[model samples]
Target: MLSITGAVANSNGQKVFKTLKNEELHCSEAEMKAHLANLYEQQKGKCAITGIAMHLHGQDDCDSDMLVSPDRIDSYGHYSIGNVQFVCRFVNFWKMAQDNNRFAELLDRVVANRVADTV
Candidate 1:
């Protein structure tokens, strides 16, 4: 989990440095790791988007959907302290570059439709 945070922070730092010429806008790896750990506890180890239980990377026999990933709450924003959340890996992929609230609404609709169809 710590390593994942480090990788994400490093990657985002590079992007922010290159684009805005200000790496300080992004959270440091240590800060991100601590934040994620707090979020994990607060979220009850569930994905922020799907409410599904999440597994740390390399946990035994977990699928991609169960993996925890750091997602930017605002797609256009920097990876700062208040801007990031822990979500399922699949949800993060599905939400790429989309407005976060819009994507959540779309996901809700999809689940609603699926439930309706089942009924």
Candidate 2:
């Protein structure tokens, strides 16, 4: 959560919180931490997009793909409670700056094609 908060901090060192509608919101580190914990539980330790189980950072067997990452549902939006979701690190990287629904559709197609090819 610290990393995420730091990433969204403005030049003045204040966290820049914005909704998808471009409305400004205020979020402190403590708020972010709590929000993230809630999201982790709400998501059942799975990636929102891929539904794959996620592992905490620095776990003994955690790989990049299995690591949990905080993702903004709308890439254009800043980090806010409503806009953030937990996802696999690889999924987050693959979905960067794309609309969530569109990315999911694309991912589904890719998976289907891969399955067909393998079969």
* Whole-model lDDT per candidate: 0.83, 0.87
RMSD of each: 11.2, 10.6
Off by over 4 Å in 2: 1-25
Model 2: lowest-lDDT 10 consecutive positions:
17-26
Candidate 1 lDDT by residue in tens digits, 10-68: 78544353454223448679988898789889999898877889988778878977788
Each prediction's total of clashing residue pairs, residues at least 3 apart in sequence or on different chains, is: 0, 0
User: What TM-score would candidate 1 get against the native?
Assistant: 0.72
Clashing pairs in 1: none
lDDT of 2 by residue, 2-109 (tens): 887876674576666775545444598789899999999999999999899999877898887779998888888878888999999998888978999999999989
How many backbone overlaps does candidate 2 show? Answer: 0
